[model samples]
Target chain A: MEALLEFLSFQDPSVRMVTLGAVILTASSALVGSFTFLKKKALIGDAVAHAVLPGVCLAFLLSGEKNPLLLIIGAFITGWLSLNIIDFVTNESKIKEDTAIALVLSVFFGFGILLLTFIQHGDYAEQSGLDHFLFGQAASLVGEDLIIFLSVGLLLIALILLFFKELTLISFDRQFAQTSGLPVKWLELLLTSMTVLAVVIGIQAVGVVLMAAMLITPPAAARYWTDYLPRMVLLAAIFGAFSGFSGALISYVSPAMPTGPWIVMVATTIALLSILFAPARGIIFKMKRQQENQLKILTENILKSFYHLGQKHQDMKHRYSFDEIHSIRPSIPKPRLKKGLRVLEKEGFLRKKENSYRLSAEGTEKGKRVVKLHRLWEVYLTEYLYLDPDHVHDSAETMEHVITPELEKKLEEMLNYPDRDPHDEEIPYT
Target chain B: MKKKILQADNPVTEVHDLTVTYDRKPVLWDIDLTLPKGSVIGVMGPNGAGKSTLIKAMMGLLPLASGYVKMFDEKLDDVREQVSYVPQRGTVDWDFPALVKDVVLMGRYSKIGLFKRPRQSDKEIAMDCLRKVNMEAFAERQISQLSGGQQQRVFLARALAQHADLYFMDEPFVGVDMATEKAIVDLLQEMSAKGKTVVVVHHDLQTARQYFDWIVLLNTRLVASGPTKEVLTDELLAETYGGKLTLLNEVSQEIKNKEFPNREE
Candidate 1:
């Protein structure tokens, strides 16, 4: 805890720079990644990240120094080239986009590794610790390294603010954007450059190998939280910045922990948690909705069965024992049937006295609607769709719980307010 | 407004020698046509016959092999604001993070231009368009929660918000319900009455006579193009359908099922 406080409190000047650098790089990348993820071009971000390596090494080889500005320029060149190459290859041949991305990513990254190795072996001065770019040495960042992030982050945020609507429209509906005369080709170039810029600066903290996760994972988590793009971008930036902060702090506490891989790990955990526990779109929420729907169907089925028994005995207020209800609905097991009976009773749909249950007034009306919808569907199907009455009963049985009041009315009007269904059975009415 | 007849000058859109291909397979071939002003035109064709490609080509979406499209007898770049496009609903990822109003607000972005925020007046216009489509109640609702019919209506609202003189709709009626289809048809007729030329890529021959003032028939080639009453004869339809009545029947059945394939590709 002391180490964490010390790391977060920025007692060490280097710790402050690393944390700030990591946060800015990641947050900007997350903003750009939201658009890429939405465009379903997520893997393109991965390719661009890997493609930046040769540029960084070539920048060092040409300049003979590790100038952050020069390295960024070099990285931008090769990164921009990589995106164009992918586009050219996909357009010129039958090679699919995924295939082209994989091809370009491997070749560019392979060339970068070769260049990096050459730089390490060359007689260049001040080349110590250059291999840190491979896995990201966030702990090694100083005031100069922070410049790469600050400049790029400002440019990214500024462009995102200025071109948010154009960027969004083109990403969501390119054909419409083109027809609307938004200078679509120029917008695509702008977006591609932004993607390249985001990847170039982000690689310093997240590293080449794990930089793609820095771009994609945060947005994936943010999507589960909201259906608004601006809010999603904000959430993704927070998630990305948090991962970056945690990764930098962990390495600050324990020097052996590599910050890049750790950042990827933390981001992946957030995405998994968001997938499982977030509200509305999350897995747990969807499962809960499914369970609620099943319970509704079960309770409605029990009420419908009770209503049928009342009709058979010519008494609406008759009380029935569990065995009698069970006898009518032999499909339901005893425990489940009893549980449903209690649930209906608790819902004020049934009156319970010594385990014998009778339908309440509201429950009677609810039960009648279900039965009415079923019979109304039956009459419509046989009368309109010409389905056999026997076959129609099974369909109407399912549609009973699904139909709304409006649909029930439409069915009645379409069937001409029929009292008797095709089966010659009395269609129950309220 | 009276029904429109195509003339040589002052056409809403004129395509000459336009061809499009995918994987070297020709989707459209030598398609030369002129659409009239203030008319509801229906482009009818079979699957893979480039009904969508035709509109896309005119909108400058597809790279034409050897042709040009003139809007209002002028270059497309000059008259872009006067034109609007509604792509097939299925072409979009409906799960996009946006509300109904946000999507409609995009219609005004062309006018608002680059690097500027939409004003309150723009919001009012978007809301008015939403109300026209009977979707004002859903302005705040996220788009993913809507049904296919509602989504189609939302797309219509977005197009209407553009306030363009020429509109191109790619299969707008495909997945919509009967009532929604009627509403859209009414909206199109109203637009035509107000002197907007609308082109729709349609598949239902049953409603072709009732819905359109002009028809452009195709089967990978220009089979016919003229007024609906003159061009929708059994012979021209047979030629456009190319003796594949069985498949046409199956496709028409699919339309009735509200599940037609919106695009050839």
Candidate 2:
């Protein structure tokens, strides 16, 4: 924790500058990334990131040294070209989008590797930091490099602000944007250019392979937390900046760790946590709600069975054997028997006498309603849907849990006061 | 008919001999259409009948292989200020993170221009549009949280916020619930009454007569087009749906030709 405080302080100017640069770059990329995420073009960033590698190498070969200006220009050219190629292959050929992405990604990455190998073998003395492009070394960013990153980041942010409305319109509805007389072609080009720029700036801190994660995961995580686009963008930027700073700090503290993987790891962890814990859409919460619903259905079904057995016997004390209940619900598993019994007993719907169970007065009424719904659905499905009598039971079983009482009455009327199901079984009274 | 005449007095849009193609295959061929200044016109067609492509071509969303579209006797760009569009519901990503009000405000962007932030007037206009669609109460709601019908209403509200003289909507009723559909129809009628020309691509045959004053019935080309009562006929319906059996046979033959090229038997 003390180490954390020391890292947080800007007492060391170099550390302060690096932290500032990382924060700016990450925030810019994440902000643009929010739109891409919404557009479902998350993998486009990956394709662009990998596609920039050959250009970076070409720039280095031409300049005989690491030139940021030449490299960025070359990266943008190649990134744009790669996007065109991806679009061409997807539209012209029968190749699916995922396949096209994979094809472009592998080919460009292979070319980059080949170029890097050629550079390593050749007699260029100043080609030392070229490997930094692969797994980013944020610690090496200083002076002009930091300045370039910060400026580009600021430019990206400014462009996003200026064209926020147009971008949203195109992203949401390209057809509408076009009809509304917005220059959709120019807007698309602008959006693609911004995304490439974001990816290029991020390659220094997040690296090429994991840069796509920085572009996608933050916004995806933010989506689970909010529905508003502006709030989503802001939250995604914050999450991205947090990941960037923490990853850089961890790598700074532990010299052996790579900055890019750590950043992606942090971002991915946040995304996963959000998917499972978000208030409205969380997986765990949904599962819990589903379980609660299932339990309610099970108890209702048990009460219903008890009521039917009581109506036949005309005695409250008359009990039903487990076998008799199982005969009524042939598809029910043995494990659910204990759970169903426990819920019924807890609800005062059933009282177990030795090995037999009987319905209480309140339980009898609820059971009769359930039986009525089951019979009504069966009659409706078989008669209205023209399903075979044998096929109606399974569908009715599923529908009984979800079909409302209002739907039940509608189904009843639609079937025109049917007396019997397709199986010749009698429907219960109101 | 009374509404159409009042709308015709304004005379907002004109299309002469418009043609469009995709990959050299004609989708919209030699189409002559005109939208009066203030009226709700329904564009209806069977599946694969180019209802969407027509709207797209007119909007400048899709390239026109031949002919052109004019708004108030001006090209699309020159008259952009007077035109607004609402696309099919399925065209957008519902998962987009934006507040309902934020989306509605986008209509005002063309007027506001670049680098300038939306002002209080823009906000008020956006709010008014939302109120027009009865969605003002949901201004702060997130887009994804709304139902299909609500989302359509929000999109309609965005188009309304544009405050343009002409509006184009594509498949606004698709996947929307009955209540939302009724609300949208009512809103479109209101827009036409207020002297805004509105064109919509519609699918439901039952509602076409009730919803639209003028109709354009299409099947790859114009089958019949005029007022709803005159254009929609059993003969036209038969022409649209009658050739399916022959078309299927042609498809099979094409498949055969592809499988065995240059067979001399």
Candidate 3:
């Protein structure tokens, strides 16, 4: 708690620098990743992240120093190389893109590990925290690192703001953008460079292995909230910055916990929560809709069964017992049937008297619509589509509960207001 | 106020000996076409007849293996601003994070130029185009909320906002409802009346006759290109669609199967 308070207070310059570095790096990555996610090129971020390690190691070896700028250039070069190789392999050969991505990612990451181990045992003096690039060491961030992040992050945000329309056009429809006189190739190159820059800036704070998560997760979470690009991008930056800040503090407060994985865990938790709870596209909303549909179908089926019984007895007031209803639909379990009955009664659709149930006035009108829709659909299918009458009843059974009043009117008009179904059964009217 | 229609000396679009290939397999072969001004022309062909490919190649979206495209009697690069192309309905991600107004405003991006935001007049023009397509009600709605027909209308409104002399549309009517289809046909006629050349890659043979006054029937090659009344003959249609082109079918099949034997080496 003390560590977290100190980190948030900015009293400790080192903790302040780490938090600020993480915020900018993750914000930039999340902004860029929104486009990458929409383009369906998310795995490319992974490949580029892994491909930058060897460049960082080689940059250290050649420069004989721990200069952040030199290492960033190295990371960008190798990251760009990996992207070009993937493009070349996909364009020139028969190998599919997923396979090519896998090959490149494993090879580059494996090579990076080789160089990393060699450097660890060598006679280099300042190579103590170099291996932290694998996971990340947010504690190692200092004044110089935050400066690099601030400039590069601000530059990327500016470029995205300048070319927002062009980037969006290309990502959504490259051919349309090209025909609209946008220089699609240059736009693509610009976007690739930005993505590479994001990955490079992010690798130091989140490390190569987990940087891809920083790039993709926040935007994915934000997508559930809104469908406007600017809002989505803004929300993604906020989500990423929040996770980055919290992850840094949590790691700082807890010993032996790394910041990169913690950041990823926090980001993933946000994504999961968004997926489960967000309106319009979330799982909970979908499940509730499904449940409502199931209830509607059940209510209609019970009403339809009652309508048949009433007609058979030549009486609209005919009351049916539990055994009689059970005999009509044996497929419905007893508990479910009882529940349906109770719900129907509660909704004023069914009335029970002395263990016998009959449709109320409102329920009778509803039953007529359901039955009319079924017959109308069956007739339209047989007459319009030339389907066998036998084949259409099953389909009509399902459509009866689903067809809206507008569709029912259209079906009746298309069938010329038919008075009878294909079976020559009289169609009821409301 | 009527818009000034440019009376350029060159035809709207002209292609000479155009050939396009994907992975060394020819998709379009030796196509020659000259489209004049103020007409709704339909490029008609079967499933693999390279109808969409012709527009893509002509618009310079895809690199041509041979031949060149002239737009408004000038080179494509020089006259790009004067042309608009609407790709197939399935080509774009409708779920992209944008409102209907934002997408329609994209049509004005060329005029807005790089680094400059759209003006209020541009926004009004975009809204005007949306009203033309009966989509003004959806202007502020996110694009993903639109139905398939509404989405097609949005794309048409975007093209209309371009105010281009030449337009290319690839199967705009494929999935839309009847109301949208009628609206598109009316829009095409209106554009034609305004002296703009509109080229559509179409599939329905019945509607092609009713919708266009000129037609280009293709089957990997130009089987016929002329007025609809003269070119849509039984013999030309047979040549364009008949199974007699077995060799072309075989080649297209090979390419579809992706058999690149030499690529392994």
Candidate 4:
């Protein structure tokens, strides 16, 4: 706890520079990455990340020192070139974008690794921190390097804000943007430049190999939580900054763990949690909704069977044995049938006498509504769709529990309040 | 290539020798046609007959191998606000995070310009367009929640929000319900009545005559372009459908077969 507090305090310049550098690198790339993710170009971000290694090595060799500005310029050039090569190859040949990405990343990255080997073997005095670019050394982020990353990060964020709508329109519908005279070519060039610039700055903190995680994970995690673009962008920025903070802080306190992999790990953990727990779109919530729907259908089907028996025997209050109900609803498995009965009884929808069950007054009304919906849908299918009476039952069987009261009213009016269904059975009254 | 190519003296849209190529192969051959102002025109062709390629080329969405398109006697870049396009419904991802209203509001962005967010009045216009398509109640719903017919209706509403002098629609009625078809046709008629021209790339033969005032029939090349009565003739339709015209030709052939009783049956 004391180490964490000490690391967080601005009294230490190295710790402050490291944390802010990680934060800006992540937040800016996440902002740009949201659009790339939306455009379904997540793979392109990965390719660009890998392809920038040659640019960094070339920048180091030419400058003969670790100059942040020269490195960014060189990295930006090769990163931008990588995307153009992918486009050029895909357009000119039968090679698709994926294959093009693979080929370019391998050639560029292989060349970078070769150059890195030569530099390591050679007697270079200023090559002490050069190898840190491979795995990333956030704890070693200097003040001058932090300023360069900050300036570029702010530039990226400003450009995104200035052209948010235009970028959105183009990403969502490029042809529409063209038809509207939005200068799609210029906008595309601008976006491509922004993407390259973002990747260039982000590669310093997360390194080339793991730079894509900063770009892809935050936005992907944010998408699960919101359906609005601005909100999604904001949430992605927050998630990215938080992961950057955690990664920097962990490495700062421990001094042994690499910052790049830790950032990726934290971002991935957030993505997994978002996928499982976010409302409406989350896996767990979706499964919960499905289970609830299945249970409701099961319980309603059981009640519907009871309603059928009472109408047949003219004994609304008579309790039927579990065996008797099973004979009618044999489609429901034995275990599920018992569970459904228990749910209905516990919910006050069924009056239970030992192992047998009958509908309560409220349960009887609800059962009547479900039956009415089934018969009404049947009448609609047969009368309007020209379907045979038998063909209508299967469709109505599923739709009975799905229809809402407002839709039921509309169906009633559209079908003109049919008295009897195609089955020659009277539809239950309201 | 025919003298029947409907060239209006004062055309709303004019295409001169427009050729579109896909992967260096010409998909839409040299096509010269003109659209009259305040008319609902239909371009009908069999599948892969370059029906969509023609409109996309004219709108400058595709690279023109040759030729140019002019609207109101001005280049497309000069009069963009006076023109609008609705691409095929399935052209974009329906699962994209947006409300029905947000998409409709995109149509107003041409006037909204760059860097400026949509204002309250722009939103009101989008709402009004949604109301015109009978989708005002669904303005708040996510686009992915819409059915095929409802999505088509929303596309129509987006185009309506443009309020352009000329409109281009690709396969607007395909895969839609009878009510949606009726609603879109009625909306088209209403637009024409208000002195706005609509050019639809249509494929259905049964409803072509009723849906459009002018018809352009194509089969990789222009077969006919004139009034609906003249363009939809039996010979022209047979030429447009080509030898693979299965559904219409089979029905007509069956009618003749039934009359003659010449089959083995």
Candidate 5:
């Protein structure tokens, strides 16, 4: 906690440099990674990240020291090479792209490990800290590394903001963009280059093994929150920056922890939370929506059964017994039917008198609307779709619960305000 | 190469000796076609009959193996701004994060050009196009919330926002509801009435006769291309869709085998 406070205060120069560098690195990666996630190329980021490892090790061995410029150039070249190889393998042979990605990822990562082991065993002072590149050592980030990361990261974010529309157009619909006279191929190349650069810049803080996680997880988690591209990009950048600061703070508190794994852990947690709890698209919300629909359908069916009985008896306020309602829909379990009735009574939509149930004024209005929509939809199917009157009832049963009030109004207008359905039933409406 | 001099002054689209190859197999064989201004033309064919390939080739989305396409008596690149395309709905990711209005605004992107953002006038034009398709209420909704027919209408609205002189649509009526189908047909007639050239890749043969004024029946080779009353004969439909085009199929297979000797399909 003291170390975190110290880091935030910027009193310690080294801690400030590491924190700032982590933020810049992750923000840029998330910016470029949004498009990669949209492009459905999540594994491509993995391949490129792993592929840049051997290039970093080679740069270390050739320069005999940690030269950030040489390492970035080396990483970019190898990353670009691996991307082409994946494309080439997919285009040439019968091998699919996923298999090709797996192949290149393993091969390049294996080569990087081999080079890393060689550098670790050498009798040199500078080679001692080279192993830090495998699992990132953000605690070791210096002033020089911060400068390189900041400049390149700003360049990446700038390019993305400038060509945001073109990238989004290409990502969503490539064929449409091409037909619209946009230079799609060059734009694609530029996007891929930005992705490669992001992976390269991110490797220092998150390292080769966990870089793809930072690239893919933020955008994927952000997707659950928005349906706008610009907002999604901004949210992903914020999420990435949050993960970076948390990872850096944890590493600073404990000298034994690595920044890469902690960063991935934070991102994974965010993604899991997004999947479980986001509104409209999340698993919890989807299940909740399904349950609500089932309850709605049940309530509507009971009300509709009441309407049928009332119509048969020629009495709008007629009461019906449990046995009679059960006979109306035999498929609903007994307990579920009781539960539906209890819920309706609780909501003041129905009134219980001894063993029979009758609709309240609110319940009657709601039930009439349901019946009106169902019968109207039935008439529409029969009149326009030419369906037999017998076949339209089963479809209208499902549509009655799902159709919104707006669609029901449209249906009424389209049917020219008909009062009777094809089966000669009255569409009750006030 | 016999050039048809008739209607040379105002031909909307002209294709000469066009052939498209996919994996060394000819999809659209040597085709010569010309369309006049202000007509709803149907490019009718069966599945795998290069109906989509022909539309894509004209828009320069697909690489042509041979020949060229001329629009407004000029090369396609010279007048690309005047052309708009609505590709197959199945080709795009419906789950992509974009609002209906943002998608319609993309139709104005070509006019908006690079770097600069879309202005207020552009937004107004996009909304106007949405109103034409009766989707103004859904302008702010995510595209995935739309029904299949509504999605098709949204694509039509995007194309309408382009305000182009020539429009190429691939399978605009497939999987759409009855109301959307009627709406699209009415929009096509309205556009044609205003002197716009619209070409649709139609699948249903029964409606093709009534929906379009001119039809281009294609099955690898051009079976017929003329006015609907003149070219939509029972015999031409048989050649275009039935097994009567087996010879053309065999010839295409032979060409594939000869040109790509070592390649496998």
Candidate 6:
């Protein structure tokens, strides 16, 4: 952690420039990625990331050197062609979309690997740095490379902001977008081109193998944190920028670590965290809510049990023993008895009269509501769900605590205000 | 029913011998229909009958194999401002992370032109349309959280925000609840009463007679089209539904054969 702070405040001009460039590129990639993720084309980013490898290698082979302009052109051509081919194959042929993506990804990547091997054994000695494209080396981004990255990154951001509405429409509903006379086809083409441009631009920094992760993970993580598009985009960009900067810093501090893998690892870690810790949708939060609900149900059931015992004893001064209450509800454990009784008494639903419990006036009313809801649900289950008379009791036994009062009334009305459940037990009135 | 063109002084949309094909196979063959200036027209057809293709062809969304589409005596492109379209519910990804307001604001994009941000006026128009659809409360809500009926309303509100003189809706009632269906029909009726042309691609045969003032029955070709009372006879119903199962089987077989040319013994 201290090392990270030192790197951030480092006086080195070269480190500052690299950090700035990484931040810009990462923000640009995540902005584009949000739309692509929303469009349900997350896998398309993976395909394009791998598909640009051959173009990069071919440009390197033909030019016999690493020229940024030629490489970007070649990468764009290949990426665009791969997208078009995927479209054609899916439309004209019976192959599914995943298969089409897999086909193109493998074919392009295979050819790229072949070219890379040939280059490794060929006469060009300056091609040693070219291996960085396979997996990124953020430490090597210099003045010229940084300029190209920043310019493309800025162009991408500008296009996204300018065509924000059009892209949103197309991503959400292409058919509607087209019918609204919004040029759906051109917008789709533009979006795909922008994604390709982002992938190609980040190849030297994030690398081909992990470029797809940068495009998808940030948006996926952002989705857990936000429901709105603009916010999602902004959050995704922040996550991406953080990942890029940390990855670059890690590589800068270390002697021989690559940037792409560390960046992906960090981004993926953030995504996993969001999936578990997000306020509404996270698994941990959902479990917590369920546990609380179960606790409420248990407490309510205990109160209902005390009310029933009080009515059975038929003495205003009656004090039922704990073992007797437990006998009525055998499933409840001994540990919960004290807690349930204390909660019932605190809520004015029960009274402790010398080591025994009796239902207060409020307790009787509350118990009646629960019993009414349970019996109504049983009737509903028997009538609406077509469950056998005998099969309804167990399920309604569990649902009694959760059904709202409004639903209980509707169920009563629907069942013609039944006075008794399927078990021939009298349903207490509210 | 014999074809008879309306003698209105100014019709909102007129399609003359409109033919559409996919890869040289005819999907919609020679359809001649004219929608009057102020009416709610329902286009009904069996599955795969090119009902949606007809709307797309008219909107210039799909290429016309052979024919012309005129809006208010002008070509479709010339009168694009006067037209709006709503596609089927399933044609888009609902999980798209756009707010209800943002989706509706897209209706003003063509009017706003390229490279300009939607201004305050555009947002106000969108909000008004949302109010009309009873979805004003959902303006800031993400579209994924909405029910099928609410999604349809939002789409309708988007089209309404366009304020186009003519609206083409494809399967607008698909997946919509009965209440939403009633609300949308009522809205369309109000639009027609106000001298707007609303063309909808509908599927429910039961509601066809009651909801629409005009009907166009299609089965890869125009089977019958006219006022609902006159054209939707028992004979036309037979023509639309009769032999449908056999036809579907044949089409499926043909597709299989085309996909696998060497499958035969």
Best model per lDDT: 5
- Per-candidate clashes, comma-separated: 0, 5, 0, 0, 0, 0
lDDT of 2 by residue, A261-287 (tens): 988888999999999998778898899
State the lDDT of candidate 6 residue by residue for A142-240, as single tens digits: 788788878999999999998887787777777666666677778888899999999998877789889999899999999998778778888999999
Q: For model 1, what is the error of residue A48's alpha carbon versus the real structure, in angstroms, after optimal superposition? A: 0.7
lDDT: the better of candidates 2 and 3: 3
Q: Which is better, 3 or 4, measured by TM-score? A: 4
Tens digit of per-residue lDDT, candidate 2, span B1-265: 1112112444567777887766545566677766666678888878878898988788887777678898899998888888887887777777676788988888887778766789999999999989988889999987878998899999899888888888888899999999889998998898889978889999888898999988777776666666677766777666654545456445445644465321223
| The candidate that achieves the highest TM-score relative to the unseen native structure | 4
Binned by DockQ into CAPRI classes (incorrect, acceptable, medium, high), candidate 3 is medium
Off by over 4 Å in 2: A1-13, A67-70, A84-107, A123-125, A305-430, B1-10, B44-46, B98-154, B172-187, B203-211, B219-225, B228-265
User: Model 5: residues >4 Å from true position, as ranges?
Assistant: A1-10, A297-346, A350-360, A364-430, B1-9, B243-251, B254-265
The sequence of per-residue lDDT tens digits that candidate 6 reaches over residues B136-227 is: 99999988899999999999998998989999998899888989999999999999999998999998899888889888888877877778
Error of 4 at A221 (Å): 1.5
Error of 4 at B160 (Å): 2.3
lDDT of each: 0.87, 0.81, 0.86, 0.87, 0.88, 0.84
DockQ for model 3 equals 0.67
Candidate fnat values, all: 0.94, 0.86, 0.84, 0.74, 0.90, 0.70
Least accurate stretch of 10 residues (summed lDDT) in model 3 chain A?
A250-259
* Tens-digit per-residue lDDT, A33-60, candidate 5: 9999999999999999999989988888
TM-score of 2: 0.78
* TM-score of every candidate relative to the true structure: 0.91, 0.78, 0.88, 0.92, 0.88, 0.88
Q: Which whole-number lDDT from 0 to 100 does residue B164 have in model 6?
A: 96
- What docking grade applies to model 1? medium
Q: Name every residue pair that clashes in candidate 3.
A: none
lDDT of 6 at B106: 85
| Reference-based lDDT, residue B50, model 6 | 90
Better of 3 and 4 by DockQ: 3
lDDT (Cα, tens digit) per residue for candidate 3, span A353-385: 989999999888888888999999899898889
Return the top candidate by DockQ.
Answer: 5
Q: Pick the winner on lDDT between candidates 1 and 6.
A: 1
